[model samples]
Target: MATNYNDYFKKNNDNDNNSNNTGGGFTPPELPNFLNKPIVWIIAILIVLAIFAKPFVVINQGEVGILSTTGKFDPEPLNAGMHFYIPIFQKVYVVDTKIHIINYKRIAEAGSMNDTRGGIKLYPSINVLDSRGLPVTIELTFGYRLNPKTAAQTIATYGFNWEDKIINPLVRDVVRNIVGRFPAEDLPIKRNQIATLINSKMQEKLDKLQSNPVILESVQLRQIILPNKIKDQILSVQVAKQQAQRVQYEVLKAKQEAQKRAALAQGMAEAKKIQAQGTAQAITIQANAQAKANKLISESLTPKLLQLKQIEVQGKFNEALKVNKNAQIFLTPGGVVPNLWINAKDKQKASVSK
Candidate 1:
């Protein structure tokens, strides 16, 4: 039975092999021909091409590219837009060419008398000799710009640490030199003049140092720390000056008001005088007119005119006596008979006599 089983297995295996030899057996699918090639070679070629094309870099507006070959800086700069470089041999660094602000605090701990020292550790406190040779601390800020043309040189000479070596030291030196010339009191009050001096000196020194890459825009005094004993004295002086100016202004205002009142009074007096004069002139004119009328009347009264007037008066009296029942006559000087009547009969007789 074992021999028969082995014979049967062998017969089946042979049959399977025979079928595979023919077209009756199944076969597995093959991979694409291109995938059969070495993938490392293709990857190496792509990397090489990418390295050669490494020069394609876009530089935006207001930016400059610093190119270096083998760690040596190129003299010429790469301007904005697309620029190309060798990948392995050359390097490009982008720098913003626009204005930038760097805020440096000169006094960090404010409002404390003990921490009055300026915040910056780069420079020692400025020593300005007063008349008494006292030390004063001054805080200030400076604005600067990086010159694009000299940026490469600055990096080469100062190794990109120019702010510490060139800028801060020069600023400290310039400030000290300028502040030393002025007294402690002048540092706080006359800061404008001090700033002007500092700016001028800083510009001169920077030009000398050939660090023209950094430009000083403006210098401003942030604070002045004085000894506690003298602070009140300085404040008092300033207050006195202000008070004096206020007093002067008040005096000037009062003087102007007094002058205005005096002028008004004078105007009123002048007007009243003119009115009184006019009244006096009018009275004199009226008196003269009255006197003239009296003179004319007296001049017209001659002796004959007087006699005619007397006769006229006597005739009027006689007529008046005729109308009255009682009347009388009185005799005066120069045969002048003034008529009077006692009764109607007497008045009729008197009229007949006239």
Candidate 2:
């Protein structure tokens, strides 16, 4: 910290002198005359200051920086990093490149804005005229991102509010145009078709842009708000359809039950017919067997056999007359018929001998 400038300079001078005389020791090179000038030093100091305390912008991830020289924006965008620019003549605009959402819903359905970021925006549900000129409300959500490659050009052409001028207008116009092609009542039923048309049309329009400024991610149709009368009519139609289906099902069930009962009755009738046929057959068979047995008995009978039977009957009568002394005995003409005797004691009773 002590003063040593004089001795230090003198020692360097002596070494230079010795080098000049002996040509043995190394000599320090002299500074250029221009570098020693005050203006040159000032310029150097200013350059250093510019490097250390420069005007700068940070291009974060999911962001791109657009450099502007004077008023014209550079076509090529700077990637994520610290970017320096001249204070007055140059500037860099940091634009987000991440996916962003635009929600079109009823005003009553919009949530608190405090939770939203620069990337998320909310608008009132789109109102469009149907083919019948009836007003219909369309609620939807779509995602998009700034094309980093063309972000600068997009910002230059559409300004920083490009989403409003480009996306919002495009979406609303597409919805109105497409929705206007159908009746209000049809919108709910054709919601998927409407949504598909909207997304494709928007993408087509975006692709038609010079730089393809926005990349559309996806589009979702959240709700189709129809008039109360249309809703009531749809509900009534659905209810009527349900009632008709119920009636048809009941009719089918009744037909099945009737068919089952008819099948059962037919089965019972066939069973009774079979039973009657069996009984008739059994009676005929029995009568035939009994007639055959009687025929055999009649074929075996002879005249002598008849006489023998008559004599036996007479012998029995004689035995009976011995028991009842006054009994009256009578013989039939042939023994094929048995003889009869009347008891004298009981006039009403008679005895028969076989």
Candidate 3:
């Protein structure tokens, strides 16, 4: 390292001079006169600087940089910041370690970067077959993050196109595999189940990635679309079921009304019978009381009582004559006649005259 440049240059110059003298077919390549100027050294320096600049990479925040030495990736990854490596012999590939969203939509979704709204809005979605072999389209969105621990492996496996190469393929395959377990009609209703299965299977699939694999955060099935014919069939079946239910309900209601009417009629008949029996008993009691009273009164009376009552009535008749002698009376049922009564002292003579 000490002053060996002089000896080294002297030896190289001697070899060149001897080669020229010996006259080999090989000749010293001549340099352009421009390259010999001062500007040429500056250009050479710039070229060296440019070559040296390749190793100094600026890894932004939320990024993980992997180094490839001589076309092979280094096991150790570089975090966000500036890093240096051997120029022309190595390269650094930056991986965004931030969480990434993988969205697929059919209906307009809120928080959509596309800003699309209702009406004829179609989006790219995953179409797969259900258990019935019917095609179903799923609109989904999920989140993921590159595992920093596996950053080197990720770069080696998918490089910069992990979404297309790894994430999407696994997602599509997992979704189809999971969704295929349900009937086409059930897919729309079983959206949550489908999403759960997809997430689980996707996580399982991601765990199998070359190195540390991607961390699958979540999976969601936003919308499910079935064939129009299937939807119509389902609707028709539902309508028919509703109609049948209504008919059954009406029949049940009619039966209940009939039962109620029968009960009412029976009750009315029973009440009438009770009322008639009570009335008959009351009338019999009244007739018996009247007959007993008449018997008692008859037993208490005698002939003497009868004679005295006649004498009293005669006295009343005499008083009545004194007041109104012209008053007429019926002597018998066959004729109207006048009173023939005289003084009670002349009873025998009055009798002879009548």
How many residue pairs clash per model?
11, 0, 0
Best by TM-score: 1
Runs of candidate 2 with Cα error greater than 4 angstroms are 1-48, 84-87, 108-118, 260-354
List the candidates ranked by lDDT, beginning with the highest: 2, 3, 1
lDDT of 3 by residue, 1-354 (tens): 444544665676678888889986465554555754666778999889978686588888888888888888887779878898877788788877877776776534445444433212223588888887888888888778888878887777776766667877787788788888888877766777777788888888877767856888777677888899889987998899999999999999999999999999999998998899889889989889888988988887666775666566556666867876754433433222222454444344433122
Best by lDDT: 2
Please provide, for model 1 over 122-172, each residue's C-alpha lDDT reduced to its tens digit, 9 standing for 90 to 100: 233454455456677766666666677777777788876566677677877
Off by over 4 Å in 3: 1-55, 105-123, 240-354
Q: What is the lDDT of residue 294 in candidate 1?
A: 90
| Lowest summed lDDT window (length 10), candidate 1 | 113-122
In angstroms, how far off is 40's CA in candidate 3?
A: 20
Error of 2 at 346 (Å): 25
- The parts of candidate 1 lying over 4 Å away from their true place are 1-44, 47-55, 104-132, 242-268, 295-312, 323-354
- Give Cα-based local distance difference scores for all models: 0.70, 0.84, 0.74
